[model samples]
Every structure is written in C-alpha cells, then in structure tokens.
Target chain A: MRGAGNRYVFWAVALAAALAAPLALTNNYQLGVAHQALIFALLATGYNLLLGFTGLVSFGHIALFAIGAYASAILVVTFGAPFLVGVGAAAIIAGLVGVVIAMPALRIKGHYLTLLTLALGEVIRLLIRSMESLTHGSQGFSGIPRPEIFGMSFRAGVPLYYLLLFALVLGVAFVWRIEATRYGRAFKAVRDSEIGAEVCGVRTDHVKVLAFGVSAVFAGVAGSLYAHTMRFISPEFFSLGLTITLLAMVLIGGRGTVIGPIVGAILLISLPEWLRFVKDYYLILFGLAIWLCAIALPDGLAGAAARLLQARNSVRGRASLRT
Target chain B: MVELLSVRDVGKTFGGLKALDGVSFGLAKGEVLGLVGPNGSGKSTMINVLSGVYRPDGGDVRLDGRSLVGAKPSAIAAAGLSRTFQNLQIFGGLSVRENVLVGRDCRLRSGMLGGVFGLGGSLREEREAKSLAADLLEKVGLARFVDAPPSMLSYGQRRLLEVARALAADPKVLMLDEPCAGQSQAEADALAVLIRALAKTGIAVIVIEHNMRFVMNLVDRIVALNFGRKIAEGTPEAIRGDEAVIEAYLGRRGHAERR
Candidate 1:
C-alpha cells in the first residue's frame, strides 16, 4: 500500500503542474478545454467512490449533474442569491437527491439498479425540459452571472481557470483523505462482499448511501463550475451520453485508484480533440479505441501502471540484496 | 461463568422445508461448544440465525439477556457477536491488514465527515486501528502476509485471516462456521490451538463443523443435530458414548450394535 506521505507528494506535484499549464498554453480555447477537463476529472473522481470503491454502477450521474446545474442556476437567477450560496446549494441539493435515489437503489442491485438510474436520468432531463418558467425549457438558461471572489470577477480566461483548478484540487484532496479512513475501508469491504462487510459490523446500506451522496456532491460542484464558466445551461448538456462518457473515463483510467479517474478524464477529453483531423469518423475511432483498451487492459491503465511500478520496485530490491 | 449468548427454541424454515427446529443452547463465557451434524442438519442455519442473518421463525436469541431476534447482522455484530462464514468471506481485493481494519470499524467512534476530513481524532483512531490490525495478524501467524491480498494467501492462510479478522472485533461471542472444512491436518491442529487460546481470553465460542475428530478434540462440550432436530448434547466424552449421536452419524445398525 502507498503511504500517506507519498500520496500527498504525488498530489502536490500534480497540482503544481496543473497550476503551471496556463504559462505554457496561452491559447484561450485550449485553456477552456483544460478547465472542462478538470471539471470532468472532479466528476469522474466522485463517481469512482461509488463505481470503483463501493462497487455501485449508477447511470443517473448525469441527473445529479443536471440537478446541480439547475439548482445553482435557479438559486442565482430566480432567487438572486450570492454565487457562493449557489455553489453550496448545488452540492446540498444534489446530495439530497442522491440519498433519495439511494433508498431504492440500495434495496436492489446489479442490472436492476442500473435501469433505475437510467430512468432517473431521463426523468430529470424531461422535467427540466417541461419546466420552461424556471429553466427556460429548450431555450436554456443564459447570462448566468460570472462568479466574484472578493471583488475579483472570474468571467473567463486564466482567472476562471485558476478558480476551477482550486476546486478540483480541494475535491481530489477530500477524496484522498477519505481513502485513508476506516469509513473508506468500509466502502471497500462492502464492494468486495456485502455479507462479509455486514458480519464485520459495516452497515452496508449506510455505506452505499454515503457513497452515492458524496459522489453526487462532487458532480454538483462540477456542474456549478460548468454553469458559471459557460454562462449558460441546457437540458441537452446533461444527456445519457454524458453519463456514458463519465463511466468510460472511470473504467479506462482504472477504477478504485485516486489518480485513475483524473488520468481517464484527461485522456478521453483530449483524445477526441486530437483526433479532429479525421472529422466525422473520429467518434467511431474513439469508440473503437475504448473497446480495445477495455479488452487489452482488464485492470485499466492505472492497474497496469501499478503493476509496472511494483515490478520495478522488486527488481531494485533484488539488486540491492545482491550487493 | 455466566451465559454470554443464549438461543432458546429457535426455528428456521425455507418454504416448506424446516432448516432448524426449536434448537436451544446456552454458551457461557470462556466456554467452547461444538455444533456437529450431517449435511442440512441446520448447524450453519443456527449460526446464521444467531448472527442475525436470518430471523428465527419461532424463539429468541439473546446476548447478555437482550433479545436479538429481529436485529440486522451489523446490529448483532455491534452487540458483540462476530462470525466467520463456512465458505471464506475474505475481501479478495483488499490487503490482509486492510481486512482486519474493516473489522475494527464497529468499535471506532469517528463519523463520516470526520473521517473524510481526517480530523485529529480520526487520524489518531486510524493509526491505532492499523497497529491493532497488525497485532491481530501476528497472532494468526499472518504478519508476513499483511500487505498481501487474500488471493495471494494459501487456502489455510485465508482461513486464519478470517479468524484474525473476527478476533479484531474483540467480540464477546465468536462463531466459527466449519472453520476446518478444507484444512490439512496440521493446519486444522494449528487452528484448534488458536480457538482454545481465544476461549481462554474469556470469549465464548461456537464452532459449527462436520469434521467430527476436529470438533470432538477441540470442544469441551458437543451438541449433535440431525434433520433439523437436536439428537444429543453432553460432554465430549459422553457425546462419544451417546447412542443417538452414533445412530445419527453411522446409522440404525450402529445403535443396535451398541444395544
């Protein structure tokens, strides 16, 4: 197992590199894509708490994302709330909804739970489309005011980038801290064997609900950031396709590892843009690539990297023993 | 010693078939009792009912005189009962030490927010839990495999890991379901020694097994069951001489020959 100190150093270096990205990439469009990738990373990391650690597969995460966006948007636009209040409300609302979904989901699992979440995502999307008075329906919510932090407007460009980057770092660190606790062990235990977890004194239902709620909080925060960054929102933005992409990010990056989802988000987000040369066929190629990765690396990219690292460490230990 | 766990007229049924029929037993503190029976004789079902996996159809299960009839498995576990499954229930993905850490979760006082934030108290508790897990692993002779996953351990080692995990709970009543089913004779002997040592620590033990020799040699007393009914109960020596137990195990001819 990786020590706490090593994990801290790894995150610190990664955060520093993220902070320095703007200096090298001066293009506004690239920065925008980078910011979106970071948001997706936050979403993926949160989703992994359920999918990877807790062994839950939710197809309704996009519903949580939509709920977060709509809740924050409604709070700021309709209620004229402060930006920070909107951000906090977004997370709280999504987490509450997560608990509601978890009540039924926890009672049933596997394919049944997946179908339930799928229906939930569709229901949320349809609800948003039908509520034209609040969400402006298909016309979408526009002119969402830029967030202000102590008189500094984060409307676009580097300031907005840094604001999102900070949130992502905090989100990652929060999850990392959770992984080091007894509660974290409970989540893993439940994932491995519900009966074993129960006999070991873990309340499996509570653990599952907490996993869903925490995962939704991450998506909510990401959604809030997305709303402010785009200065617009639409029901179309939170589609079942978006949920599938997030699932792909977690699976390809390697589930159950702290760095896996982030790695997955970055690669999946950038892969499409890099393949733009192929134009219309790029999506098909992307799908094929994901398929290949799934088949070739059953443990995902992170698991492969972990195995390689272990191999290298053992070799070094053997060489030292020879001396 | 006072009774630590009590089962009175407990019964369980699946559809039309009775799995356990009005079974009654009391386990005193520091006592080691063996539950032996043929296949489908309700030994495992009794463990399940007592552990709260199954609610007894008719009767009561109590820990220290408090009824645990309708409680959940986790609640029963919190009430100071820990059990191992007949087929290994080890977490295959987690390290051996991590598995023991999970067992200590019930006794830990930190809440979800505190754990997520890594508050000073929570961090200290985690550190203490890790050390305790290490100690338990050492007791079970699995200290060298602390960092290894369950998949890496041999079958016998995994069995010991399960016992170590249950012991980590510091339970008042420990239940072992067929713990020596597939073990080598040597491994089974080691496990016997460990179980006896655990009982000496003042914890009541219930060993459910089909291995007659192993159970007979390890337990102070024995309870025999056949077709969901108790056939006999007595000291290990008395159980060996009991005509009903002989009939239950061997056949009607074995009882006739004794007569």
Candidate 2:
C-alpha cells in the first residue's frame, strides 16, 4: 500500500467523488456542505504543513486566513480586480503577514510562541471588528462576488463545488511535491532540532519564514474560496473555533503526512453533518470522541491505521511461515 | 605565516563568575593547536565565542582578518568557519547521511523556488551534495551507518559522525570541542589520527580536549588555559613540563595517579 498502487487508488476515489458529487446532490444545501468541506480541507492541509511537519503551531493561522480573505474581498468589492488576481493578492498579502508575525515568535519556543500568535490573532480580530468604515463593523460585508471564470458565473452550489474540488487537487499536489524535495528536508531539520540545524549551517530563520509564508499562502487561498463560496465576508467566520477545528483535522489525520490532512478534513467536517439526528448532543459527543481519539491514538487516524495494517501483515507472515 | 583566525581579549562572564577573561589566541593556516585545561577552564567557551554562540563582553573574533564579533551563528558558519559541539549535537531524528546533508547548508546552491519546482539544476545539485556527503561519511568510517539515525548509533560513533558533519561544511577552519570526550582508547587513537590527517590538508584545526595523551599525540603546539587565562603556549613536550600546566591538572588531587 505504500507504493504507486496506493496512490492510484486514492486518486481514483478522489476523482470519482469530484465528478459525481454534483450529479448526485443537486440540492443547494448538499452542494454547500461539499463546498465548505473542500475549503476546510485546504485550511487543514495548510495547518498540517506547520503543525505536523515543522512541529510549529500558530493560533494566529486563522488571522492570516482572515487577512487573505479580507484583502481579496477588499480588492474585489472596492477595486474591481479579477477573481484570479484577487486570489493571488490574497496569497501575497497573507504571506507578508506571516513574515511579520513569525519574526518575533520564531526566536521563542513552546507556549511563549503559541500565546504570542494567539494574541496576534486576537489583535487582528479586534482591528477588524472596530474598523467601522473599512470592514463594515461587526455586521460584515455582504454581496461578495461568486467564484467565476470566462464569463461563466458560479451561481449554483454545484459549480462552486467543482471549483473547490479543483483547488483541493492543486493544493494537495503542491504539498506532495514539497514533501519530496530538499526544501522539505530542510524544514524537517529545523523542526527536529534548532541548534543542531544551525550548527549544520542551516539558516533556520529562512526555513521558518518560508514555511510560514507557504502555509499562509495556502490558508489565504482557502479563505478566498470560503468568502466567494458563501458570497459573504465576516469577522465571525474566522474564529477560534475554526482554528481549533483546523488543528483538529491535522491532528486527527496524522500530522506530517500529505494524505492525512485530506482524510482528517473529510472525516471531521462530514461527520457532524451526517450526525444531524443527534444534533442537540452532537458537539458534546464530537468533543468526547476527539478527546478519546487523542488519548488512545495520539498519532492520529493515519498512524493508527498504519499500525493496525502492519500488525495484520505480521500475522499473515507468521501464518505463511507455518505453512 | 598569516593567521586565518584571531581572537582579541575576548571575555565572557556568567553573573558573578568570569568564565573567560582577556583570552586571546590566533590560528595560522594548517596549524593543529590543542586547547587543554581542567574543569571550568573555559576551553569550550573560547570555541563558543569564536563560533558566535556567545557574544564576547569585552573583545572581538576575526575570521580571515575580518571582525565577526556580533554576527549571528549562521553568519559565522557562512563565513567559512564551522564547529562540533562537545555534546553530540547531531540531529537525532535525521539519518546519518541526512545529518551530513544538513551540514552542507552553506555549500548548497539551490534556493526556494528552484527546489519548489524540482528543476534540473536543483536536482543535480542535490545529487552532487549527496554524493559528496557519502564520500565524507566513508572517510569517517560511517559508511555502513549512513541511513542509521543518531539515536541508533553508539556514543563513539556519534562523536565521529559529528566530525564528519563538520567536514561537510568544507570550512577553512574547523573547531572540534572535545572530539574524544566519550570515546574508548581505540576510538581516541583513531580520532587522533583523523585530526592529524585533517590538519595535513592545510585547514586550521583547534581541538579542545582534557585527554592529555590524545592531544599530546595529535597537536603540534598546545595552548593551556586556567580560569580563562593562558598559562603556557608551546610545543606539546614543552607544555607538559610547565609548572602551571601541572598545577591546573592536579589541583588538590594527588599527581600520582594522573595519566
């Protein structure tokens, strides 16, 4: 399963879903859920690049995501830029914000950095909330343009769903390529040990900055898609809750692994929707489940599954030896 | 003979204690200088100051006649000086080969965008670096342990791996802080030979060690330190007979059982 065959199977399943999702679910409600899930997938993957691979966490990721969305939203709403340009602008703006935030926090470690980033995010939220003239205050800006291209308006949820799926594919591919390269090795070196990396002549400052920038770019892209899909923008959307959910997806899927984030996003985002029958107690049960999973399977779903599969394979090997 | 590295009255203080005070030394091209002292002698601190780990309170360090006092650690490394820590600072989660690869950070030409696209030039550079790292590993007798992580290697093997990693930087001057700290007699002999061979390549080497026998055999000249002050600087034979050197090593302890 660790070979090309496994990758083929994964891509086949993903492709089938991308093609059939719109056909099977014509209702706007279902399409909306699918679209939102894709956006979450992007956010969760971006978080995975930091939390899983580099062993750095930023509670301010939501703020960077919000900054991207706001930047893009402002461009489209006020300046009338093209949709693609808005997305690019969002990524660059978010990446620059990442550099500013990572500079101070990179010098510190553990909870100090965590708290600093969280406070930074809170500061961004406050600024957004108080800027009555620019950000429209707490009510937020409405009538955001839908994701459109070549004069074909993405007016329906089904079209938006396809757009998000395409984005998810591109994002996943980019991450996969990064994981296989030398830059990825440098990032891993920084995460494993800072002094060790520096002694080896690694400019850890550059590595951390690059990781932050790339992760921010992805988060920004996700945020842009979220704004467009909803056709609305708000300070309420990029909350602490969303940040926690994004982290949960990374942890649950297994941090550091490429496909793990996708698995995490799909399960966590879709699970609550499928459990609507127990809507009243849904959050309580979900939290309990996450707590239990974290304690029992700390490496996340991917690690647990790999362990189980290895055990089964070992047992089979023993059986074959006996024969 | 031009000095490739110079330290001028560098001083470091830890609160009420002065770890290093008014310590000055110079390393000429291809010189194998041994730094020897008893416990709390500041031999390691001198190396730390040169490597930019600790900024000196009172003086300066110059590499190739250029001042490097307040430069960052990476900047110091990039300026053609590399070092190995007394405690094995090899990346534990990385393989031995990968550990060496990290040491080649300054040598790598591939940048962010080049690596992101996996372009031909970057891939070629990566392959070339890997080959060079492999060659260095073989030279240090770590060829078989190429894929083994630091956590899996023995203490002596880890010590050798640190030297191999340092060599990966291709530095003009290499400082080894106690390269023979936790090694056996056989390992120490082998390392002493390796240090001599490295010095033969015309790269200045500074070795910090408490093992008098190893340093005596490996170094051409020895610089002895006591409480951050130089007591004697001469040939290994000359320093061995110096009264201050004996006093530094045998303080309160009888000189009978000393090696």
Candidate 2's C-alpha runs over 4 A off are A1-28, A305-323, B252-259
Q: Per-residue lDDT tens digits of candidate 1, residues B1-259?
A: 5778888998999999999999998899999999988788999999999888888899998899999999989888889999998888988778999999888888899988888777759889888989999999998889999887888888878888888888888899999998887789998988899889989999899999877889889998888988898889989999998878877778898656757
iRMSD value for model 1: 1.0
What part of the reference interface contacts, as a 0 to 1 fraction, does candidate 2 reproduce? 0.56
lDDT of 2 at A4: 60
Candidate 1 chain B: 10-residue stretch with minimal lDDT: B250-259
**Where is model 1 chain A poorest over a 10-residue stretch in terms of lDDT?**
A1-10
Cα lDDT of model 1 overall? 0.88
List runs of model 1 lying over 4 Å from the truth. Answer: A1-9, A315-323, B255-259
lDDT by residue for model 1 (A121-172), tens: 8998999999999999999999888788667888868988899888988988
In order, the Cα lDDT scores of the candidates are: 0.88, 0.84
Q: Count the backbone clashes (under 3 Å) in each candidate.
A: 0, 0
**Model 2 lDDT on a 0 to 1 scale:** 0.84
lDDT of 2 at A12: 89
